[model samples]
Target: MSGGRHSWITFVSKVIPSLSLSLFGQVCGISGCFNILVGCGVPMRSINSFALIGMALSTFFTTLRSFSTATLQLKASKAFFLGFTNSIVSAPMVFFDSTTVGRIFTHAYIYIYVYITHLHTPTHTHIYMYIYTHTHICIHIYIYMYMYVCVYIYIYIYIYMYTYIYIYICMYVYY
Candidate 1:
């Protein structure tokens, strides 16, 4: 009876935060994409100001969610490692034009940590865990690759449009 109760408590503590983080990631990803689209037509200065606020909020929520999950499920060292890994992995997104690979890599790093931690414990010793983790990683990689391709195409279009507009403005001003 006590064992079952403990299991239930563990499940609630772990699963709830995991689900929350997943939901937050989805929402932030969608919102960021929407903001990028809307900002294209607005003044760059105003859009950048608004985007700064939004990016701050997104970072705060992501950190909160990830920290909470790590603290809940992992040992102190592991939790720190997870947070550090995420920071390092996410850093490239600032310099890179596209985030699809960085995002997927972050997920893969977390999944790998999870797999390693699970293997260290006797209680979690199961073949299904291996299969489940690998399958999830594979699916995420495939999805992100497809999404990145589409994003690259959109970026190319945006660049071409901007170049065309710039050329037209230069000609009109000079003529």
Candidate 2:
């Protein structure tokens, strides 16, 4: 392919579908869980079971997406280094004669350093931060769900207690 255009096209093909699928899966799973938690229905056991399956599927798709993206990034970085090495090897003898080996290495080192700092470092950090925030959000959601269920349980208990007391008083007075 011309100028490695085909490789990029292939990378995109491998990446985009997984990315979209993962996003869709996550949305469906999260929404399903949310609905199961909030909606009125007595048969939550069945609905929650489905939501759990959806969430597991979502996690699987997300892992697949991450693996694809990582593989693509690895291929890209390898190509970059291969091209750099080829360029150095093909350079004219005169250029090497004029430039010291140290200077050549220094130049390559600087380029690679800058490239890694500008590209790889930020990407990894972004991924880490994104994962952190996502986990944090999930924890918060679980906490809220716990609190919501607890409140309802307490309310039901209180209602039952009061009803029992009222019935007992009525029976005692009538007797």
Candidate 3:
């Protein structure tokens, strides 16, 4: 949010999530390799895509924090700061050619957050506590619920749907 080259630096900061995607790929690849050893034939491409999506997800928080930190330092020129950083970085990957798992993971990140935030769950939440510690106990509980339902349950669904979609496309279309 600087005036000159600083603006460019601002843009560069947005790409931090993309860098994270690189790390995500490495981590997911290792995990996938382990799964393969355990007798799963998950497509390598899907694993790559999933890791990138994870990178995108990690990017969202990074972008927000960066913005907050920048705001604190009081840099001027806030013309169109990067938003929803994870979605932005991961978008091309998703549109171009994401594995089913990758797609699911990316989508789930958004959905999981939404679903978890729904109803402001764990109604026993104490706002005063968060005011002091800057953390919400209820929110964390909701997030864990999201992980259990959205992540754990849906991984296999992603795999199965991708497999099914691929088969259907191949059998029904010549392309």
Candidate 4:
């Protein structure tokens, strides 16, 4: 009887919490990614773009956050190298695709919120400082790149529209 009770207690304390955490992460990842992708013109049909983007963003942010925090706490040099590598690798994806940039920002915001709520120690005080600096730098870079892309696309579309309008006006004048 005691053994059975102990097993139940273990399950409740360990397994249930793990399962709940996994479920929460999954829900946040899926929904957050879906909303961002949908807002960015990715269709909800034929491809699970929502889940894929969501999971990618979630995993990317979570791993990055965890790595950054751990490195900061440990005062590791590898963190800087990792950050540089990440920026280089992710720059193209973000620059070419506005949707990916949106997803990344959204995921980062959500991850920060979740991280803050789960905080538990005074020793973790500097964690936010690290997060803030890293996030600030990343946000600036992404924003500049995204804006550049948007402006280029907008210019292209505007030129096309202007050309069409000019042609139409010329045809009307000729007639």
Candidate 5:
């Protein structure tokens, strides 16, 4: 019963936020897919850019804040900054180049951490308590990322396809 209680507590405290973010991504992806199939202009590009910028800035500042506060000797701040910056810059490029299909899949990334953590168990010999301890923190890391990817992908695909069709139709009318 103690184990179950601990698991439930861990889940509520650690997994729920990540799951919620993942689920939000899933919904965004589905919305993108639907937009592609049936034209619905929803300011995907601007929203995406804003999301990217906001997420990058937040993560950057948060880490700097964490480093000064935490007593840990390890310096993971640089890597996190790089990753956060890279995601912000790269998401728009990838989605615009690929098919609208990519938008539908981007949200699945937020699930990676959660699902992976579930694969790990807290055992006496394994020392996975550390892993479980940081579980909730990971969600804060990826929330911006998942949304940025999906929105960028959706907007790019919609723009590319719609523009192409609009141009072709215009040419036919002119000719």
Candidate 6:
């Protein structure tokens, strides 16, 4: 189908590049850190700036890949569903007259679900497995964010308690 072909074109144009960039970023991040750790002249003196840059790039590219795949999946599903619906709607009255409403509805639903589910299954599996396996690569970022929030909360609570104690002491001494 033209829609399927178009979806593949979109996937190749968007997803493949995103996946490659994400892998490149990951390599960049790892190599930068390794270079710094091994005390390479340039990296040791430069404060390993590449590590941070690579991390940012990796995060961005990974997120892009995820979003692009999701978008592609939705677009393909919509295209297929719409095409099927259009054909059903534009069919001759004779075609519908012989088909019961329940049968038509059942066939429509089954076809949409079955076709979409079965389409490019191996490709979907590879994409999903990649996503699942690599998901943990971003855990450090999440951990850092969680630690930041925790620190903020701790500071707020400490300040609040200190202020409360200060007020209590002032009232006690002044009274």
Clashing pairs in 2: none
List per-candidate RMSD values in Å: 17.8, 18.1, 21.2, 20.9, 20.8, 16.9
Model 4, span 95-136: residue lDDT tens:
756556456656655565466556666534544444444444
Off by over 4 Å in 1: 1-3, 39-175
Could you tell me which 10 consecutive residues in candidate 5 have the lowest summed lDDT? Answer: 66-75
Q: Give the TM-score of candidate 1.
A: 0.27
lDDT of 2 by residue, 1-175 (tens): 2788888898799988878866764554454343233234434333345554554454444344444444454456457656766887888889888887557655665564445445544324533333333333443332233333334434443554455445434533543
Which ten contiguous residues of candidate 2 have the minimum total lDDT? 139-148
Per-residue lDDT for 47 in model 2?
Answer: 32
Instruction: Output the worst ten-in-a-row residue range by lDDT, candidate 6.
Output: 134-143
Query: What are the clashing pairs of model 4?
Result: none
The TM-scores, one per candidate, come to 0.27, 0.42, 0.22, 0.25, 0.25, 0.40
In model 4, how large is the Cα lDDT of residue 123? 35
Q: Where in model 2 is the C-alpha error above 4 Å? A: 1-47, 119-175
Off by over 4 Å in 3: 15-143, 150-153, 156-159, 162-175
- Cα lDDT tens digits, model 1, 1-175, are 3778898899899998878866865664454343344335544433345555664454444344434433344344346656765775666656556556557566765675566555654322332244344445554453344334334434443564455446434533543
Strongest candidate by TM-score: 2
The worst-scoring run of ten residues by lDDT in candidate 1 lies at: 122-131
Q: List the residue pairs that clash in candidate 5.
A: none
29 in model 1: Cα distance from truth in Å?
1.1
Count of backbone clashes for each model? 0, 0, 0, 0, 0, 0
Candidate 6 has what TM-score? 0.40
Candidate 4 residue 37 C-alpha distance from true site, Å? 2.8
lDDT of each: 0.50, 0.50, 0.40, 0.50, 0.43, 0.49
Query: In model 5, what lDDT does residue 3 have?
Result: 68
**Residue-wise lDDT of candidate 5 within 51-123, one digit each (tens)?**
4354334333433332322212122433554575566556676675664533433444346445545665321
